[model samples]
Target: MQPRRLALANQKGGAGKTATTLGLASAIAARGGDVLVVDIDQQGNATKGTGIVATEDLVTTADLMSRAETGALERAIIPTPWDGVDLVPSDISLGNIESDGSNDLVFRLDMAFEGVDLSAYDAVLFDCPPSLGKVLFSALIAADGVIAVTEPTIDSVEGVQNLITTLEGVRRRPNPRLVLDKIVIGRRRNTGEHIAREAELRNAYGDTVARTMIPELAARQDAHSERKKIHDFRGGRAVALQVAYDDLLDELNLTSSRVQEKGA
Candidate 1:
């Protein structure tokens, strides 16, 4: 099966983008699928959280950006601590990649992921930056789909409208095949505001809003503090996250071999 490349994004902070990326990647890989997580966030939370922080310099995304000349992207693909998973870890250099690889900008990521065809891997997840920056655009242009993460707030929804506008503009010219797989709602609460927001979102975006709701669980924060996924940690908090994200994964179709290949 052809790999599904998802640029998981949300310009706003605290939208559970990082947590979702880490949790889903691990959960999906644990199901006997080969996974490659491409992190383009300068903060490198995904890199640290996934235990690839020590693999800096040698095969980091920054090193690939430095030598995009040879059209060697595989050099950046690093084997993570997990057997079924790998990482295209990122650092601060991800921000400078666009300007650095100016002439080769359009095909930079495509060129980097050249040889090791994604068909072999079950999924390719791009942990995007928190802004509509260079790294975010590059991933959007290169990926098969974008999993837009959103919080239960009017402000975040407003940002999605703007993001969609920007994406629409890009689709008209640059990446013609870009598709939004689904917009995952993050940090949900049973509060009145959150309840109202969810209804508004469904009415606003219709089928784009996914059925799963990632509840506002403390486990997400607790897991982050330890640099471990919620599923990998112990205690009741960990169990809560597993239940919440399990519903999410089921909605995302990651629990099965079936996957919707965007831009197919």
Candidate 2:
């Protein structure tokens, strides 16, 4: 079977989309499942968080999207410091797609994966940019599923609604098979507003909202700063972050059979 491809997206900044992308990748890697994180965001936070800084000569997601090369997909995959996880790193150059104005621009990302075997990875995560632009549209067209990452706030909730609308439009034409897999509540805090917003999301999304919420923890940032996975980090509630992600993986059905057998 093909690997599950997911686009972790939120147009609103500070929604923890990048963090969640790496966190889930770390979780899957810790379980001995391979993961490929495709960083399509111009900020390249996901690329840097995984200790990758794509140089000018390197083939990145931008190279993959620019043209339909024979081995472009293979060239873009780079192994990171984390075991069992690879990356298709992106940089500022990815922003050029917005202005390219090619009729086929939106389909280029999907074309990049064509005829390429991706069964090596258990999951492929795309960290989309914070906008409803061509980049995000291309990712939606390319991915099999979308995971909306958001904080429990008014703006974040609204952002999820907007993304859902955009996703619905994409499904109608570009990608009829695309599914909104889940709405993840990230960087959750124990405040009245947060609690109320969480309730609002669950009420609106029902079981589509993930039961596991990523709590506000400093260890996340600490691990990212060190360019290490949360499981590899040694300080400041790292265990808590790991546990939260484990629960989140369970909710997404990403834990491999080997990991479950080992745990059992």
Candidate 3:
């Protein structure tokens, strides 16, 4: 089966885009699914979280995006410390793509995947940067769908809208098949404003907003710092985060199934 490529993105920073990517990947891996996490962010937090240190010898996301070699994507795939999870890791060098003036830069990622069989994996997750730029555009161009991760704050709601606008622009031309699969609310809190904003997002997006909300728990940070999957991490509220991600994965599976059924 062709893997479902998902771009986890939010133009605004601190929207828990990386956290969501790792969480979902971990959840999928725990369920016996193989996942490829392509870290398109310069920070490389996802790469580190997967316990793969970026190095000069490794073919990183920059190489995969910039090089036209037919085997680049295949060669970039490396096993992470976590079983059932692979990575196309990134580093600070990936930032150079933002400054490169190549006209086909946005299409490079799509080109890199051409003629490659990704059937070995159940899903491919792209960890996008926190900006609406070439990297984000490249990811969207290559992805089958997008999961816009945001918090339930005023700024985050605006960020989701900006991402929705960007997705619409991309779909109008380059990726007409791309869908906004989900709008997930991450880093949720019990604050009155956050509660109100959560209700507001649910009201506005209706079914598009995910039913699973990732709570504001320090365990997520601790797990990332220790380079352990939240499922394996024993920290503050780790089990709760794991359960939330499991629910998110179920929702994602249902969404994918519906899309497949519609296509059929």
Candidate 4:
């Protein structure tokens, strides 16, 4: 059984896409399930957050995207400090891939995983760049589902709608199997604006929006800075974040048994 591959995507920067990806990975691992995180963002935020400092000689997502080769992704997979989690890291050089003129560039990421078995893990997550570019398209082609992560700001609805348009395009052509699995509201606050936006989103999307909303808490940033998982970080309301991510994991049905049954 192949693991369910999902892309965590939102076109707007600072929308907490990377944070959600890492948080979910931590949650899955803490539940005794394995997860592989593919960091396609040039910023390498996910890589750094997982306690990895990629030096120059390491194989990265850039290498996987540069060409269409079978089993290349296996080489890029490296162990992270977190248990039951592996990573395909990225760096600033990945930015150059957007400019390449190759007509097959968007399909390379899918090709890179050919002949590689991913059944050992519960899920594979693609941490996409905060843009609707070639990299994002590639991830969509490779993934089975997408989790749209967004904030409760005024413009967040527009951002999610735009990503939905992109997903429609991908489904029409490149990946018919790709599905928009859920819309996760992240970095939420108790302010009136946030409350209104959240209500608007639920009204617009209805049950497509996830029931679990991740709150904006200082412990998230603090854990990222300390290179620790939210479940492992103790102090300053970290327990809230841990509970949120755990709820999200269950809400998304990302547990090993559920994912495997889906794959089967």
TM-score of model number 1:
0.88
| Candidate 3 deviant stretches above 4 angstroms | 254-264
Listed in order, each prediction's TM-score against the native is 0.88, 0.96, 0.95, 0.96
Residue 79 Cα positional deviation in candidate 1, in Å, after optimal superposition? 2.5
lDDT (Cα, tens digit) per residue for candidate 4, span 14-51: 89998999999999888878899999999999999999
Best lDDT among the predictions, by candidate number: 4
State which candidate, 1 or 2, has the greater lDDT: 2
RMSD of each: 3.8, 1.7, 3.5, 2.4
Q: After superposition, which runs of candidate 1 have C-alpha atoms over 4 Å from their true positions? A: 54-56, 66-71, 98-101, 258-264
The C-alpha stretches of model 4 lying farther than 4 A from their native spots are: 256-264
**Model 1 per-residue lDDT tens digits across residues 7-121:** 8888877677888888777666555566788888878888888777644454666665555544465666777765667888877666667566476665566667655556767
The digit string of per-residue lDDT tens for model 2 on 68-115 reads 555457768889988888999999999787888778888888888887
Q: Judged by lDDT against the true structure, how good is candidate 2?
A: 0.90
Clashes counted in candidate 1 amount to: 1
Q: After aligning candidate 3 to the native by TM-score, how far in Å is the CA of 10 from where it should be? A: 0.3
Query: After superposing candidate 2, which stretches have Cα over 4 Å from the reference?
Result: 257-264
Local distance difference test, each candidate: 0.74, 0.90, 0.90, 0.92
Return the lDDT, model 3, position 126. Answer: 95
Instruction: For each of the candidates, give the backbone clash count.
Output: 1, 0, 0, 0
For model 3 the TM-score comes to 0.95
